[model samples]
Target: MTIKQHQSPHTIGRNFRLIAGILALAACAKPANATDVFRFEGFGAISRGMGGVATAYDTGLSGMMTNPATLSLMETGSEIQLGFDFVSTDIEVKNKATGEHVSSDSHGNNRHPYFAPQIAYGRQIGSLTLGAGVFAQGGLGTEYGRDSFLSRASGNLDTELGNSSRLLVLNIPLAASYKVSESLTLGAGVDATWQGLNLDLLLGADQVGSLMGAGRVSGSLVPVLGGLPDLRGAHFSLTRNSPIKSGVSAWGHTARVGMTYAFSEDTRVGVAYTAKSRVADMEGRATLTAIDGVAGQIALPGDITIRDFQMPAVLNLGLSQRVSDKLDVAVDVSRVYWSDVMKDIKVGFVSDSGGDINILLPQDYRDQTVLAVGAAYRASDKWTLRGGFRIAQQALRGSTLFAVVPAVPKKHVSLGAGYAFSERASLDFAWSHAFEEQMDNEGTPNTSAPIRVNHSQDNVTLVYSYRF
Candidate 1:
């Protein structure tokens, strides 16, 4: 393996290490909502069946995130549910112009796959019910080709540009579903969810020259200017730590109220609402280490930066109808305030050199609205069928913050089924496909910077839900 040589270190720095560029890209990875939690439909069954259970979900512990109101409605008794999730995904990136495939695939790359486990348990006593569960909200892991553009052209010498992140949120809830009268049932739950995120950004030799788009330019070669003598063997490296910080989220506390009204002998209508929490305080560290032997070693002090983050509230409405002795159908409609995440991220820092730090997050995307429609049917005495669809706008299609590492969007079709084997237990399975979409940031019309990018994601998930 060989690293190319250049006449000037500035051009070399621009064309080679792109070490600064790496820092810029790394900056974007830690958003106010840095990691994803509470996925669209976490388990395979919910996904394959379209996650339409907002109104008629099983009374298991997993129902807290979807609709706490359902707590008063169903009976799971003393049941314990446990399962694991397996995921596999593929990504294709290209250049918008000339239909060129700029992103490398055969550079010895592997698809994204992971194992996640979760459990839910619930019990009722008198008019009060209690539930608790440990489950991952949602997250993404993407580490592609070691020989890709970002890797080959950069100064990592390690020869790769890799990044991955995982996040999980735990929900502990207590509630009561009271029978106010013969025709009505009223219920409520206090929700407290804990959040956490883990992130990593890596670079190798292959990613060096690619950072500056590797063209050509020349400059004076000397060590006295406080820069590398040339762009070749001088050796340069930078490692940064995202300072350590812990948060007991302010917005994790809220109240939920739900009411179920009996319309007739076989029909019921339910409505539920919950107050939103004030989410803020994203404080973290920024420790940097720099080595430019050609220009001499220079290490920057660690900096502390914080951002104020917020999340929108949610509302759900659902209905359940019994059609025959062996059949029933259910559907639900829900809304989320994605617009709350529409602002650019901002950061304030305290420089060790006695200077105030201030920087604006470059996120300039529109608020989003999502629509979920799903259903489940007991087709026979021993079998149940489910299907559903969901649609939401993409925030990364053409944003100012496009990087070699991309963010995933949610939009797909799902199908699933379940079988009752005996009086004590049952089995279920589900499958889905997210429709592909194209992206290009360079030529989106009227932009000074001309960097082009295009990509899409494909995914598969499997899980198991049990009753005892």
Candidate 2:
């Protein structure tokens, strides 16, 4: 899908009851941000092969996050895995600026590399199989350099704004599967997840200079139209120490449970659910400073504590069939309860000079269902191939809260491959590209101006696995 917009991320701070972190992006009744992207989806090859299905029969390492029921699927000997991913994102935005009424087009780059490790061990102790592992799941991130259109607008509006965000989770998982009778296996596990959220917003005269992203930058007269002040002549310090950033630390827990049953030798069914979590210990703080013109700028101190804001609960039910000895297929139906995510947030101002607090919120969304299907084929003792598809529903509730975080059309396709280098070692590679639907962004500071954006995703992953 095409990517666009961050105005939505700011809303999480406006309300506490919606999303978990005032520091993280706000939760919407719809998709949070059309432009927001996740890199964790393809950190490893196995996740790509089965459309991220492993909650029941997971193996290798990263399986820890895909499902807890997979505990019993592990080999008695331990397995360790190493993985890495490279992403190249390109985003185009059409902007309405301060001085010029004419619209301008700007482009940006998303460059980042990620590393992940996964390990799992299982042993038969009488009637039960047990396993444990730690792995990374999906989250959101954005690092936008200040650009010309935004800079000119910031200088004229008397605002300094730059943002950086990161979110990661440490998953402590414990699970077991017990075989009852001859045809049923029941399993469950709790993923005691501790989430870490961080955000940084910077402002100053150089905010424009940074957005333009060139040499030592400078700001001139504040541009104006009808009724407004021209507070100008601010030269910003480009030092890292001058600008300030605000952040939060939050903690919470969620659970997952599942059961797998075989109707025949070639057919099996699986069901699982992940619980929702709330962060009560979320702490926040913002720093204040000036780069060039301190006399005219706003001096501010940030705030932190809020209510039980956080992510939602998710559930999945699946069916897998072995059509032949070398061919296998599976399908999963999943749900996400995004309606529990509505909140209003606030940001404190130094002088209250044209400022009260930054207040905004996400709209009421509904539960959404996804239909995902995948297949795996064994070409030989050393080679395997995989493919999958998923249809994600747009559960947006059209309202004022939906303005900033516009949802996009949902559907995805993936392909992957695996090769055994030895009896204990293998290499895997996978790639997926999502098609985006066209959408319009309306009602900015300017009511008539429109930002048209489309969404698309290109994901590639590589993994190394050694099965002992």
Candidate 3:
């Protein structure tokens, strides 16, 4: 349905005054992960509660990130949203040839569940709406022990089997919106994002065994290894948990633009586009070790630098309609350009004692599209309920899907509710779950052995808002 905002110009001063009171609170909040890889399904509880069908809806401060034009539909005042996301993820890797699996829990102790915070502010001033928000781009990671099946299959020593990787991106968005006519609004925004990444990974036993077995010399050292009897083995091991670690951080920028149009009292449409972000290279210190049988030991100690890492662009279209007085429905379709940015993961290693080595991890990811539908019901003057579902195509499949980054799940279901304590204050809560998904790889450019990955996730969100 079309949610309208008044633009009489008389309330501009009041809106600014109200915004001043909540600016501090809004500045202290941040966003957490949803159900996407390096990307969240939505920006806030209200958006996620409705399965991210928010492009055409007025969802207060949170929705501004999805479509800044939605800001023009806010009540003639100021508001702030503060919330947290509790996320739990399960990741498992299997050796398809041996029929053994290793769970993330088999590694070192981890928090198991983690928390992500969200905050935002919106204020109406004359014919314009102003807003600011903080949230995280989604990411996943897990740690495994050296003694786990992951290590045994690789035939690596106890110290060489451990693995882990974690990525975090904090986005600070500043946006503005203006009403172009009685039924149309346009908006734009800029996001200054800070990204950090910590990765402890390996080539694993399967890939190493395949490469050495081929003896085709993928790199200069591969052919040399074939001549060494000690290096020719059926199994191999590699790890990243040496004295030096592979961790890096950088700053990036992205832009967003959107528009909303009201076709009638009962129908509205919205469209938005986010440009790809430019990110800097990640450099860190780490040791690369490869062991075959008992006498095969290859140690490459160096500073690892991953270059040309970038975030993909996105396009979203949505429609919202009122089916009846108390019920409203919304649908959204979004496309993510993963293939444009993730053709391969290239790492440059400068040896501490000698030369340089370059490793290319081919991803060949495909663009992904997501479809979402949601329904919201105003059950009573004080209560509102929401339910939604979303399904998306996975970015990686076939042999390119690796253990380190398993973006497998494709379906998500969500439920949410809102309770109003007063005309200006309320609480909102949402829960979502992603069904299990798995991928198997027989062999690819990066691996010659059979490997499998499985994944699932759950998220919970709570937000408190006040309007003045």
Candidate 4:
């Protein structure tokens, strides 16, 4: 953590404290209730309003997350931007055979209307621009009450069988861009990321049997108690209320490279590649509760480890054009290599009472292709209007295990506005709505009945910026 030599000691100390504060805030933040398979469609208000298009166009300091090369396109000065997103998600899971539905909104503990904060600063020096920021990458979560069918199916009809799952990722990026020529810019960045997961889940005997039949369960418990003759009515659960208090979390790192080229003064093209993240195993403590018809119920405190969980690599290509002096249009295409990273999630549990169990949750997610298109109109000297559309292919491959962590929305529409109130201050606001999507798991191995999940989401972002 070194600051520029020209800065005074007091300034350096203040900056260090600021970074620490940012990390603390990010640690307590919740998931965004993702739109693109656990990933947000956009990063900042400017990008959200313009359909997540920032590769080829200047999008203030927030461009560090999308296309760092665009940093060089900013006005020659120092700029700071601060913003937050209010996310509202609607999710429902239904057991088609039982005709019972559980809505996330039904639970009093359901943490809806999640908030994600964003802050960034960039400065221009000679032909180079340097910037840094903290923001959320993306995440997914769901909550079901104890009275839901899932809890009843677990044979915990009277007990408080808390059922929920949450996954969150936050990123702090340090980026820089160099203007190679009047028409070309090159940039790169390094990201320090923190990822956390909390799960309070219960699995029924049939589901466990299916997993065992598929060879997805292993460890000491399997060889010992797994062979018991009366294991037919068994139930298993791992419960943790909060990630910060007692859940699995890890820190990881990644990098990005991007370049922007101007075909003409009115048209530009940008390309960016983000490498996959390398995260440590998420390890934490939870209560592993087991219940069986013959052996009754037992609760064992244990440690759990989630192995080799990582984010997918992505490639983005974008084109921006000035349709008129007052109108600008942009389109972007992105490919996410999800299959490589989301094949399966392996969890290993070790209890103090000498119980070792390994479980595999199959994701089998496919690669995703996303397309975004947006336009901005300068209505007056102080006002600008923006609108955009985005679409993506389904990533999950019909896995019944995804019922709790559904990321099913595939289409989104957004609208935004920007207002300049003074020579050095401006405000931007954007809203995005994801259409409801439903998916069914008919042929999945772990389910006795078909499971259907419906998901929809809304995001609103407001940002204020100042230039000096």
250-283, model 2: which lDDT tens digit per residue? 5666677777777887887777777776555555
* lDDT by residue for model 4 (1-468), tens: 011224445744564465445435433333348788877888888899988888898778888998899999988899988777766778888888778898875253334334667889999999999999998888877777667766654443334566777777888999999999999999999999888887766666667778888989988877655554444333334434433332788899999999999989999999999899999999988766665556655677878899999989999999999999899999999999999998888888998889799988778889999999999998887788999999999888765546677788999999999877555666788999999999888634445457888888888877777676
lDDT of 1 by residue, 223-297 (tens): 221243423211111112222222112235556677767676567667766555444454444432222324433
Query: TM-score, each model?
Result: 0.66, 0.69, 0.84, 0.89
Best by TM-score: 4
The collision pairs in model 3 are: 30-117, 30-118, 31-117, 31-135, 107-144, 107-145
| Regions of model 2 farther than 4 Å from truth | 1-44, 55-61, 84-87, 96-126, 151-160, 200-246, 288-295, 305-307, 342-360, 395-409, 444-449
lDDT of 3 by residue, 1-468 (tens): 222343234454454455345433432322122466667777677777888788998767877678889899888899887776666667778878778777765243232234456788889998799999887666655665556554442443443445555566667889999999878999999999776665555564556555435442244444443455544222212223322222666677888999999999889999999889877787766665655565555666777677778788999999999999999999999999999989877766666666655666778888999998988999987788998999998888667776656767789999999877556666787888888888888864454457788888777777777677
Q: Rank the candidates by lDDT, best first.
A: 4, 3, 2, 1
Q: On a 0 to 1 TM-score scale, where does candidate 3 land against the true structure?
A: 0.84
Query: Candidate 2: lDDT over CA atoms?
Result: 0.48
Residue 290 of model 4 has an lDDT of 65
In lDDT terms, how accurate is model 3? 0.70
Q: Give the lDDT of residue 323 in candidate 4.
A: 95
Q: Candidate 4, overall lDDT?
A: 0.78
> Measured by TM-score, how close is model 2 to the native structure?
0.69
Lowest summed lDDT over 10 consecutive residues: which window, candidate 3? 235-244
lDDT accuracy of residue 60 in candidate 4: 80
Instruction: Mark the regions of model 1 whose C-alpha exceeds 4 Å error after superposition.
Output: 1-38, 42-48, 56-59, 97-113, 145-147, 151-167, 181-183, 199-256, 274-306, 347-357, 394-397, 404-410, 443-468
Overlapping backbone residue pairs in candidate 2 total 25
